[model samples]
Target: MPKTKTERVTISLCPPVDLGGEPGWIPFDAPSLVGESLRFVSGEPDGNRFRARYYRDAEQHLHARIWFGPETEGPPGHAHGGAVAAVMDEALGLAAWAAGYPIVVGNLNVSFRNMLPLQKVVTVESRVISAEGRKVMVHGRIFSGETVYAEAECLCITIPGK
Candidate 1:
């Protein structure tokens, strides 16, 4: 028997929903010196692929709530590894900035534990683990509740000026 084909549907990749104003969390405002040029997760507010909200805990660790939208899919319903890496990169890099270091990532190492489902809200937590001269090391994880999807380490260096 031949299967019937249905008409294709059109979909728009709209921006993710806001997850701000959670209890015991304070919003971390990124510096606007870069103006509108930066294009990653932290730079663009209307980014359709991924949506992230930066926050600081009482202990001052950098944490974020992220939504992996449909546009980031790579394997079936899961998010692309690059998309996941990009999120970790931005979150971990911002951790350095939040800790008062104006820097750029020198190297980013990401380990995928499990595939992340699209359109799901996940939490990213980061800490500045070590600092030596111009080097800053940050560790982070992407998880939903108790399920960890990925972990990353980002080494950042001071951006010479500012």
Candidate 2:
């Protein structure tokens, strides 16, 4: 499969919205940031130039918004399947990390539901289902805007901290 070229975006995250429907300011990088938040996930492997920025949207929700350039093309104008899986793995793993457990993939099951266009933004969402001791189970979906492109389920186990 061909590689996917990605670009990072400069973000201006929105402030928190109050339950009372009023303006509430929550710092983007604050610990107790209510609602969704985004953290930096690394790009493609260091030696590779394809840049993919990942984000942790919440304690249980992880997101990856990707941009692949024209050079990275599959089927004329679609993203490669392997590229999509890689993004899913990274995003889902981070979701596990966000829930206070860093993990390895115990197992992963993915289904490619449709063709995903290249050079467009792709977003991934992951959520933790539950946990058993060091193992956390997760499920996620990849979207091309409002369209579903792929879905995945993963089991992750935390490694002991040094």
Candidate 3:
């Protein structure tokens, strides 16, 4: 006996979600500014590792719409702490770059608040809090609505003559 053909349904675990549409928000291209050095996190736009879109608000603060994919899982069904830290590392360092500071992250301090669920779209907001001589301080947080997942403070040191 021959088996009949059945329909195959393809469902995406990480579907495209809205970042935001508020006024004074402009799209930002990280690769255009810092080249391919950001390939670690924002490299794969559609890959299972991570998917992120960058933006800037009216105040020039850097914000990102990041999706935690299945590949970033650590806990049974949640994203790993290291994955969250990676997002902070990139986003905060990029925040300094976006603020017209050519620098590298010297120290990254990440504090995990809540475990992040995989395949969910979350927001990471960063701003250059202070800049004095060669040291630039940037703070950021990863959250979904009112639920905060992780927060980080990045200290960036300006490169000489660049």
Q: Assess every candidate by TM-score.
A: 0.84, 0.64, 0.88
Pairs of residues at least 3 apart in sequence or in different chains that clash in candidate 1: none
Residue range with the least summed lDDT across 10 consecutive positions in model 2? 18-27
Question: Which is the winner by TM-score between candidate 2 and candidate 3?
Answer: 3
Off by over 4 Å in 3: 1-21
Off by over 4 Å in 2: 1-41, 44-50, 56-60, 70-72
Report the backbone clash tally of model 3.
Answer: 0
**Candidate 2 per-residue lDDT over residues 1-29, each given as its tens digit:** 87698878864422222111112322122
- The per-model lDDT (C-alpha) reads 0.84, 0.61, 0.91
* lDDT of candidate 3 over 1-162, digit per residue (tens): 877998798756555656563467799988999999999998888777788989999898999999888999999889999999999999999999999999999999999999999889899999999999999999999999899999999999999999
Looking at model 1, which ten-residue stretch has the lowest summed lDDT?
30-39
lDDT of 2: 0.61
Candidates sorted by lDDT, best first: 3, 1, 2
Q: In candidate 1, what are the lDDT values of residues 26-72, reduced to their tens digit?
A: 98775453334236675545566777777889999989998888778
Please report the TM-score between candidate 2 and the true structure: 0.64
